[model samples]
Target chain A: MKSIRIVSDFNSNQLIRLWKNINNNIKFSNNDFNQVYQEFANYKNRNDITVFWTNAQRVIPSFNDLLEYKDFDENVCYDEVRNYAISLKTYHKEKSNISIVPSWHLPLDFKGIESQNWKFNYGPKFIISKMNMIMSEIFSQDENIYLIDSEIWFNDKIDLDINKLWYTVKVPYSNNIFLNSITTFNSILDGVLGKSKKIIILDLDNTLWGGIIGDDGIDGIKLGGHDYLGEAFLDFQKELKKLKRRGILLAICSKNNEKIAIDTIKNHSEMILKKDDFVTWRINWDDKATNIQSLMNEINLGLDSAVFLDDNPLERDLVKKALNEIEVPDLPLDPTNYSSFLRSLNYFESSTLTKEDFARSKMYKENIKRIESKKPNFSFDRWIKSTESKLKCIKINNSNIERAIQLFNKTNQMNLSTRRLNREEFLEWIKEKNRFVFLYSLKDRFGDLGIIGLVSLEINLKDAMIVDFILSCRAMGRNIENMILSHIRKFLIEKEKDSITAVYKKTSRNSPILDMLKKSDFEEITKYTFKRNNISIYFKSDPNIKFEEINDKN
Target chain B: MTIKQIVYKCLDEINLSLSDGDKLNKSKDELLIGDGGKLDSLALMIFLTDIEKNLKNHLNIDINVLDDKLMSNSNGPYKTIGTFIEYYEKKNEIN
Candidate 1:
């Protein structure tokens, strides 16, 4: 049996399951983590690996107690907990190559909402907060250190605030702890090192196809519709396209006849890729290295982010030799392994794909229209009109619950009402007689974004306070927010309310909302604070965009 | 920060280089410091003060860590890098 060791703050049933899945011979060293800590102070003696399972000094014995320290000052608690985390470093000092996986308390999606006394269900919030404090303790020397990826907290925290207690149980939309957390953890691990390349730079001719485009005259290029080697390039392009849709930038760098290559992507019906799909393109007879350098500058990305894919090893080597940053995965000898090889690529292993990832390719494609109209007299507003902005506000629903939660946790800039809601707290709000939560989705002449913003409100009949208001970063710089608030103000006027008060809480990251409030000339009662909005702000706006009220129980 | 604080930060960074088992049972006397400890010679390649700098100006000390006889004493309290720290601080005090 293969042997492994499990190190965790707590010994639990799920951990045992994970250990069994990994290896039965996995010796779990349970420790009175508290004692294991004191011993670590000496830096000489070693704790027995098998004893960590029973350590009474463990930070928390089980998952249910995630928030015993929640009401305490988060940073102060971290300041204190950081010492214990540093104490744990003694193990890493001696065992530089040991791989230890962490078991977070609750997956990110669970909200602790069973009852007022619900102690154990707080799940990922507490664990993640503490882990965040401890994680920074690591030195640059340890090579065997492993990272855990989990997003359940983000999923649960945001989704919990949406339509509340269906059956009065405060239990959230779901409790998919294992899979959600695993995927979340996977993405964050990718983010820290950023293992996934956000952009995949490709080559034309023999790289994406069987023959050079200059020789084939765009007609003879071998992109398979039904046959053998053309099929190979077809599969390769499909894989590349999938990565593009997931928000990876696709750029072409080839010494090709520009018109012919354009005809290939534009006229070739069998071509899975289109000219409009590429964020940026470099199709010139210049040296491949020069073309790639120009393309990197054009795309505003460092060469390291560009994954140069070419069939010619010499060309790949030339770019790699000249620009040390680019990742050139050596092409296989034959095209047969192309799909399998692409599957093995890990440049853009993100934890979760937000709505923004799905729309990046098209948004970049709009640059083509911009470039086509580069005359001094070309109007920017006229071009924006061609890409009509569409804002669709859908209250948080089952399908979008996961994404909404992700946005809630991840959105930093334009966040109003930044107070994170526990499952129980959210349940309390939703079940209360006077609260409502909803999310907003915006698209333009570009595409249909399913959902992109969140706004929650609480009502006491005579007064209303906004609880949560945040927008995705991709949707920033657009007036999609003003459009949504217009809807809210109208809703309040219909209810005969005197005024609609909005709260803008202060956080280090939510400064953008402050900026918006200032730009709109809203009444700032105090720093990082706001008062109610009168209906005139939305009703008196220009009629360039359509404003429609959407009311449906999600 | 004082020399004792500098010494503590340096030792903490070095102790951080070890395994969990060694870390949990780490003794004040087992800490390796300068050229006198069990850390591979490369650990000395990093100026001991460089390691202390990461502790956020929490410590400052001037000590030659690359000396050959840092931890060679068989009977003295400072036999390894870990023990050397214990002996040097035996005479110094920090509150």
Candidate 2:
């Protein structure tokens, strides 16, 4: 079982209870209250995730001096925060485990001089804000050290009854704040575990716009301009566009005339989402559940990766019952609340935003183009050759570590082991004797599919085992799998290894990997385990693709 | 609603946050504090704070459930759900 060691300044029993309520699989270790640095130094479990939660005044005595309106050097407070951050980073580098430090915030009702609080550097609020900024900047440099924005849990009203709770029970915040914090924490955990939703399937008629597109037509739909509902719909579309920009694939699953809907998306002045913004759409009169399944199949993504949004209750219920894996959120009755409600769900939370994430929708769109360009009678090999695909193999380093971790966790279908690891865990694993990882970025005439494959190897004596063989579904079925195996064989040969072995671990979605292994000329020594004695003769390079090896100088 | 109903409703609301095994029974005879109680010291604090907030919102009457008398009394206000309801009814009447 995965363990979480929570070390906090205040009593953390309530937080532990709430977190346990959220997830039972995790084993929690709540350290003694107000023993922040002691627990940090005492932490030895390299696999367990450590959470360092502290109240500003409790941890830093200089912060209390500032809070009391006494003369204090701001640099001292900053130095303390920096010390904590640097210590956490050093501990993380040593332990090679994840550490979460929540950004400190003053209480909502902190009574400071109203105008001077934000304007002056000496103000308590100002110092705390600056401290949080310093913490963000320093913590961001380390992948394992996560600095969560704790301020998001608070609001205009004081969430703490300082008089009753602080003195009586060492818990400062209200139960509501704790509840909200747990929810955000759960989202963060989901993001860290690579379980965040990737796609949003939207209904166009009443969902994307204010009115039904079938009956109202393009001109009659309430989209933008002076009307409140129109502006709301427009804003909602803008929110969806922003999600698309951040790599969440948008698709339409509406029962509508495809031509008319496409026309409205293209021609409508108020529509923020254009026709090309969607990677794929199933705008048909068929059952929406079937359409959604078909769209997922076409896009090569799982049903669990999608969040369906539809204003029609009947359609929502139908989709929810038919496609249980797909998350169908109940759209609010009012169109004005749609954008905020969607934002509140936090389905698209990502731990690290990479260049590939920004270009994800565009990459999928290009994949769709590649699919459409292929003739119905064209041979698979010829079609792949026609695309002029190129694979660049690069050793994993600091620059590509985040994206490498993302692919390691997200790819399921073509994965051999399906082992999930955070950046620190991965780095630590590779630091062991005779372990290496190769990341492959695929590019065709269509587009650059950024780092879609990862191959991990473990060498023992003259034999080498493929620890992890992961390829993104987007790059599959294009001779990329054959090329990856060939590349591995060549590397092992260069390393003077006698044989290369791969064991296919069976998962619900990983049958595709088994098929690839069978076709790649590996003799089945046992069930699910394949081995090749003559690595040079067994694996052949795909003539359709060109391979380049990139060395990381840094 | 009666005072008994209000207290029971608050208990039901608090049960939403509690784990399934730790959930408070709606029955008045159910133990609420000390041994055999669903709440520990921290949970009791949350329960009492929630009760005070609910009473203020629903009845517009503010009462401190954690008063000096209640803390010092051998027979505290929260011994069982029935005792808590009885104490709350008397407190509401006094208010």
Candidate 3:
């Protein structure tokens, strides 16, 4: 029974009734217009998240006034609304509250727009249009506020009586629109809560292009240029490329000859995505379901985070039957519809993108080389040494804050407590004098992996508590954790600390870190607490690899 | 299917959550709307919209339930199930 409190000007009972069907712990405020602002202002230091929902008409009762006077300068109303929104934004800027500002839906000056005297340059005919712009500005600059396209929901309005309900009862909308609003609200909530699919596992043959490359040959496949089907497929690939840039990992799973498919991906001139574009590919005559599981394990991502796309219904059905947790969308029979279908799915939705997102594919590409180098002739120690791994420990600063926040929030497998912090919360916590935030970036002979590790510590006079410890999966298997632990140990010894306590909070995906403290030589002081004496630093580095610290000059 | 069957099917599709007592037979002159109606305001809206959508999709005819001309007629077709079906049959003939 997790509860959410809502403060709204209009009646949200219909919306609440629909939301209760999905989540039943909704606490709605009384529908008094005067109390909404007070309720929002008084919602400080509360445990439950408070949401402010206001309609365009409720915000400005004189919205109809502008429609009546075609010559009305909207700035008077616009300035009033902007000031109100700014005040509300400042009130909840630091808090974890949410605001849903909807665009205006009333038909204002529609007749004017259609008339011969209409001018396109005149400030948007609808006052809600101005409000939408204001809300967009607030949403883009601020962290928590979200804008709902109230006009679209109103266009989706089916019946007229629901509009009449506004005069009769206080219901803002009818049941149909209310149901849709709940759906949109839930998606926004999911994005804010850091819950989303992480990887997209695509089938190459008919999925990426028009024909099978194994039989059709590389140049014979329909891809790019004026060919309608080929262009459609290319457009889909281009869209997926944009997603990859936004940090959604892309991998290929196809039932073709490994050498032939690899050659095609490497040298195909028409291909928008080349060999290095994919993080990993399983191009063999194996069951796709089994290959998907292998990909999941190789990437260390949950099956729930993988989206499977293929053109053949049989292959799609096979994977769906095998892995029910993976999202397998039904492909349209025509290739032209592929891009629109993918767009409509909205599978990869993230609230925020950090600096680390742009270079994620490059990092995964480096890991591919490391995986390939682990051949039978290459011993584990020999490979580690020959790669020349370097772990550069540095103090966290504004320049690398985004990546540090990303590592803390997204890394699950190698995380200690799995604690998540939003951008503002992370910034506020880092400002505390007693807190020490340590971050590091790794590089090797293969490639330079950007900032991939984070450690947040809350230190007191007697002892230090390790609040957060997380490392990107690309930086694992390199003994970087020991390097971090050793650095912290040196810092504690210099501060005259008595003991260092590290707690292991177990999550479903953090099993790798369950025995992390014990492996680092910290004695188990209690069921969850592990403590270590302030002794000399102890860590082992491979002889062949030289670990170096990067200074500000570098 | 007959008009009566289409009306019954549409009502069933729209009001799937209706209770057993509320699922009474739709006979002629039965109070179906307004103050003494079996359906509430939202239910009545859903019923009319669903009927329009189903008829257009399945039968290829677009009938307006809230037409000003129709509502202002001498006999309002929204009085009961039988009168609505009769009106629909007449409207379809003219179209």
**Where does the lowest 10-residue lDDT sum fall in candidate 3 chain A?**
A369-378
Candidate numbers, best TM-score first, in rank order: 2, 3, 1
Q: Model 2 off-target regions past 4 Å?
A: A156-158, A368-554, B1-6, B9-17, B68-76
lDDT of 1 by residue, A438-463 (tens): 77776565356667788888876676
RMSD per prediction, one decimal? 29.7, 24.3, 24.7
Q: For model 1, what is the error of residue A542's alpha carbon versus the real structure, in angstroms, after optimal superposition?
A: 65
Write one digit per residue (lDDT tens) for candidate 2, span A1-554: 88887778888887787777778888888767777788668866664677778888888878888888777999898999898777767766776467778888885567777877776678787889898888888877788678888887886253554457777788877767877877877777777888899999999977899765644567888999999999999999999998998899999998665777798899998889988889989875555777787788787777889999998665676677667788999999899999999889977878888999989998987875322321223244554566678899999888999999998777766789989899889988999879999999988774687899999999999999999999875566567888888889889889888898899998755766887888778899999999999776766778878899989867
Fnat per predicted structure, each in turn? 0.00, 0.32, 0.00
- Candidate 2 TM-score, true structure as reference: 0.69
Please provide TM-scores computed only on chain A for all of the candidate models, following their numbering: 0.37, 0.65, 0.60
Worst 10 residues of 2 chain A by lDDT: A369-378
DockQ of 1: 0.01
Worst ten-residue run, lDDT, model 1 chain B? B46-55
Candidate order, DockQ descending: 2, 3, 1
Error of 3 at A447 (Å): 48
Ranking by lDDT: 2, 3, 1
Task: Please write out the lDDT profile of model 1 over residues B1-95, one tens digit for every residue.
Answer: 65445555555543443443433124555534434345543333332434323333333333433344643445455454455555546534442
